[model samples]
Target: MSQGKQLPEFENEDDLAAWIESHDTSEYMDQMIEATDEIEVLRTRFSTKPLDVRLRTEYLEAIEELAERRGLPYQALVQRWLLERLTQEAPDLMTK
Candidate 1:
């Protein structure tokens, strides 16, 4: 690492990620340090299976428009709606 060049402070992960995306890490290799303390890692796994459903063109277009407005994919919006309805109809099934 160059003595004159120092790592810039980032306000958040997005800013750090942006900086890292544009810059070369090899330049800062000397400054990088490995963690010496013990660390615990916890991971959660979710199992999902794909389901295909057919819908009319008009309904699909409407769903896509609504999903775009809500900043979510149309498929995700549909999944959410299905989950909501299922929860309403069978709350006990959702607990499992």
Candidate 2:
């Protein structure tokens, strides 16, 4: 973002919303500049098989606590941990 960048002054949220309704997002795309180390987009998709497991209450609580602090679902945190371990140890395990 550049300093002193001026945006059109709208009367209120309704005005802004009305303006947006008439505008194409691409019209302002040029105003969007990528900052250093910023990502343009993030997307993920893959076929997955569901895995269900019961965890002891204490373990579940610990996972939930850490996941909350990291802003991730507990299952995602678990999956990432498993993936990291597999990638570090036997990378072949991740394929099948």
Candidate 3:
């Protein structure tokens, strides 16, 4: 690769991963590790917002039951359901 040359934009996560691997020398690998760690920290920091939700026992039970039926943890199911609802209700929130 030439100095000052720019790589093309990766279209998806898989493409990005492949590009990173292809570019991996010892120095570039270290940079990739640091970049991945920083990305994880960014994801955690952004997802750290507090939510004070109040759900009735019946609703909670329903969620648990649905989660059990889907073989997913209750919290995972609840989070996915809430995400779906928010996405449907306010589609532009994700774009922002």
Model 3 ranges off by over 4 Å: 1-46
Which residue pairs of candidate 3 clash? Answer: none
Candidate 2: tens digits of C-alpha lDDT, residues 1-96: 434434567889899799778876554555655568956796777888999889999999999999999999999999999899889999877675
Count clashes in each candidate, considering only residues at least 3 apart in sequence or on different chains.
Answer: 0, 0, 0
Instruction: Kindly give the stretch of ten consecutive residues in candidate 2 with the minimal lDDT sum.
Output: 1-10
lDDT of 3 by residue, 6-40 (tens): 55566899998887778735443323334344333
lDDT of model 2 at position 7:
52
Q: TM-scores, in order shown?
A: 0.53, 0.51, 0.44
| Model 1: per-residue Cα lDDT over 1-96, one tens digit each | 568467888899899899999998776767767669988999878898999889999999999999999999999999999999999999989957
User: What C-alpha lDDT do the candidate models reach, one value each?
Assistant: 0.89, 0.81, 0.72
Which scores better on lDDT, 1 or 2? Answer: 1
In Å, residue 40's CA in model 3 sits off its true spot by 15
Best by TM-score: 1
Best by lDDT: 1
